[model samples]
Target: MPKPANDNTRFLVADVANLEAEIDALLGAFPDLQEDETLRADMLEGETSLQAVLTRLLGHEREAASMVTAIKKRADELDARKKRQERRQAAMRALMLRLMKAANLPKVPLTEATVSITKGRDSVEVLDEAALPARFLKVMKSPDKTLIGEALRAGKKVKGAAIKTGDDTLTVRAA
Candidate 1:
């Protein structure tokens, strides 16, 4: 949902893909180098012009192998996290449907909910239900109005607008 989350997934996949491509390129190039080396060694064992270059390339190949190993491990971790997020999104969708049924409203997917509250000049960003310290902020309310009534009963100075849901009232407060 957040930009960082999306970017991270894309980056992990790209990293793995790039590493695979590099490995394939190295293996493809190795065979030709192998034949050249055998010919040169037979013709002139002690003096091969390509020996230094070959040594450097082999060192690079070893370094690339280490990098690829690390990338593979990181890719596995990202894959697991991606799967977990998919599961969470599914569960949240189901919960939203149940809430809609209870409220007797047409089912709708939950979009990003924004609420404003007191904040210091240096305050960094907005808050959300997913990142709240508590699941929901309990607010007293009457049947007259649900959302605004809950906000009025919160007993805190309303700095600005707030969003209310069946389970949570997200009111931003500055640190």
Candidate 2:
């Protein structure tokens, strides 16, 4: 199974855990500033220190986010390159199969590689679905949602379908 791009990362850097602990201690030492806004003006020095700590934490978060974006971009580039390589490989495999078939050989053993061509299952090509034999077709029960939506959109009375607008959502982002 393929793992997701956003897997957990273990970035070995400065001891952020210790800094977080110190920040927690500072907050614990003066819980009044957060709970009581009036205490903010009174404890000007403590407020300044808290602001600095918060700023540092925010900066660290921004740095980590930027790094994540960079990693995702790099991963996507590598994935695209890998797919291109796989396509080239498939192309070579196709060439090899054609060579083997043209030479009327089931298998050709080269010095560096071996080529083999074998028969695959008979694939069905549906030229006209209506003209297909009963054995080639399978009947199934399903709803035609498109037709139902069209009927509802035209204000026609559909027994099992109704037209309702979707809800609106507000998106928040950097200006």
Candidate 3:
């Protein structure tokens, strides 16, 4: 018979706890069985529940380890591909910038689009905020909390910058 939709979704918490406790007790009694010789002796000499559970757990552990290794290898491959793509993009941008500098005309018209060598607005890099001109230190970004954050760290009360709580996330691993 087919099970209900939520049947698989439901957790057997108590059952898992009972199994864990039983496994722990069994492990405590047969600590020496962790060695290959002792374990092989127990496994070969008896057809028991402990043997079955241990075998199942070991198989699951191996499978989990293999899966984890495969996933990490895949992720590393993806990261390498991303880095290659980023390098290509950067090289293309550099070539475009070189072409713009070489052109005599600022506005170069093409069939589909226009490329302009327009200069971007100059951004001020504050070396010393205390020594900076008050007029120049005016708000460029609305709700800017950078100054306040610095001031707060320097033992001053700043309205915008307060230490906020960090976020929490789950970390999964094999048991």
Q: Please tell me which predicted candidate would have the highest lDDT against the true structure.
A: 2
Model 1 weakest 10-residue run by lDDT = 43-52
TM-score of each: 0.37, 0.50, 0.42
Winning candidate number (TM-score)? 2
The residue ranges of model 1 lying beyond 4 angstroms of the native Cα positions read 1-43, 107-175
For candidate 2, what is the lDDT? 0.69
lDDT of 3 by residue, 20-56 (tens): 6765666577776656776745653473355555455
lDDT of each: 0.57, 0.69, 0.66
For model 2, residues 1-175, the per-residue Cα lDDT tens digits are 2222332312212234444565576568878767776665456445335455545546656677899999999999999999999999999889887877888999878898776777898997778999888998788989898989988888899886777789886453444
Model 1, range 70-103, lDDT digits (tens) per residue?
Answer: 9999999999999999999989867766666677
Scanning candidate 2 in windows of ten residues, the lowest lDDT window is 4-13
| Candidate scoring better on lDDT of 2 and 3 | 2
User: Candidate 3 — which residues are off by over 4 angstroms?
Assistant: 1-48, 105-115, 124-175
